[model samples]
Target: MTIIIMLVAALLPAVLLWLYVWKKDPQKEPTSWLVKATLLGVALCIPVAILEMGIETVLFGVDGGPTNLADTTIMAFFVAAIPEESFKLLALWLILRKNPFFDEHFDGIVYAVCIGLGFAAMENVLYVFNDEEWVTVAIGRALLAVPGHYAFAILMGFYFSIYRFVDKSPKIAVCILLVPVLAHGIYDSLAMSSIVDPSIGGISVLVLIYFCVKMHKVARKKLLALKEVDKCDNESSFT
Candidate 1:
């Protein structure tokens, strides 16, 4: 029963968010491609885990302490954010670089979000099941962490679409990879601060919530703007 609940809690948010993003696309991506991208995301976790472990060993010497601000920031940026987003970007490149269905701008969001949620799903499960307070952890993550991943992916996809379809510049490609890593790093840094100082941590959590909400709105606006561009292109082609 606990396992059942854990699976549901871990997976339900990702599934719901996936459908929501999929529906937002004016031209729906192929189901197979989305599924494949998601699975590749899960597969990429293995390498990410290995990299994270190696990084932690090198940086911390050992685990299991209340992290200081400097340690937390370093862990967040270099240990967590850089490696995770870099690999996700690589997965997106590998899966969709030459795919036939990646014609529209919004396809970037769809594919990137699929990969993000796939990573989130596997990640959520591990965190939830390993903790003693699984329910509390699961609920908190559902609200903040999972949606946070979605926002990061949307940002990545937004820049990636511009890079791929509009400008095709090397700089934009760099933005596609770096922007999300910065965002994810900040988010994790704030969340981890609570361990060292609860008062600061409390303030950071509120700020993080606001940041996530703002990012969500920005991502939605970008998606709508891209859809409008697609509509104009389609209408022009018809005439």
Candidate 2:
């Protein structure tokens, strides 16, 4: 049917992105913990999604409530932004909080990115398979929403790395979660309000891409530094 075709089309982008990220990082083999983290993120999101829908339905009266600004704000802030970020952070924590591979600042970014991508992949499949207009929805999500999620997670990772390397403070992690929640909420509000112009959206995506690339460099640098330090330590011990 036409619906099936659309669904498949929609899944293509997500699949492609997943494959690309996986292939590009073959040095990083996935662990059982990574699978668990992905599952945790997905699981935690369910109740949060229910809460979002419930609040929206109550406020908007079941017709999308014409953007239902108040409800949307509630959904964005409390439901979508907060819960989602918390879950993603949980995913990161569950995997990396005390793991051996988490020896450098960059490891936070790597693990967090994996969690984000896993969540996005599953979520994308659901979207694409759930509707007849899946192709269009998929394109929109892939082009905008999915990348935004990844970027937000990357920010969390970046902060997590900083704190892990220096302070080891829980507050930094809390702030990491809040900052992304706020950004995600604001983005949802603007996106729903039609206030974000196409140019702005395009630029926002570009900016996110730039951030990812910059963070990649930061992660690589830290990793290399750690390797050098380890090498020196090994030599000194032998000498």
Candidate 3:
């Protein structure tokens, strides 16, 4: 009963987001590949969790950790952002490595969003399913965390497309991994700091809202920009 509802709540955002990204692609990739990429994302969560635990052990020695802004930032970046985004990037590469459908710029973002939402869906289940404030947590994550992952994926895929078909330099290649980590890290750090200092919770929440809004706006523009580029290429090819 409760568990069923929780599962639905956790997954609803991912489903909506999946459709959103899928519809935005004018020339959709094969559904089979997207589903495979998404399942890889779900499977990658296991490795990502293990890697975060290992990093946490090395950083704080299996005990109390990240009591302040600086340490929290470290945990956010190393423990959370770096591990998760790096694995997703690796997964993206593996999915597209020999993919014949990797023909356009926007395909990158579409596939990346599928993988990201898969990861987010599993993660949302973990966070909201076990909590006592299940409804609140579910709603908050649907609004924030799920979208944050979507935005981060856009950043990764935006830069990935550039690296793959445009620049391919050391710089743009690095952005494929770097931009998401920075965005994810900053988001986590801002959100997590409140746990250490209740007094600053309000300020942190406000900042987090601004950050999420700003990040989504940037990611949205990038997604649309790539979509337009793909459309232009298609039009030019037909002429």
- Per-model TM-score on C-alpha atoms: 0.96, 0.68, 0.98
The residue pairs found clashing in candidate 3 are: none
Model 2 lDDT-worst window of ten? 18-27
Candidate of highest TM-score: 3
> Candidate 1: misplaced stretches above 4 Å?
64-66
Best by lDDT: 3
Candidate 1 lDDT over residue span 115-150, tens digit each: 999999899988998999999999999999999889
Model 2, 167-205: lDDT tens per residue?
768888676687677767866655554332444556555
Q: Distance (Å) between predicted and true CA of 227, model 2?
A: 12
Q: Write the per-residue lDDT of candidate 3 for residues 170-239, one digit (tens) a residue.
A: 9998899999999999999999999888899999999999999999999999999999998899899999
Candidate 3 TM-score over all chains jointly:
0.98
| Model 1: lDDT to the true structure | 0.88
Cα RMSDs, all models: 1.3, 5.2, 0.9
Better of 2 and 3 by lDDT: 3
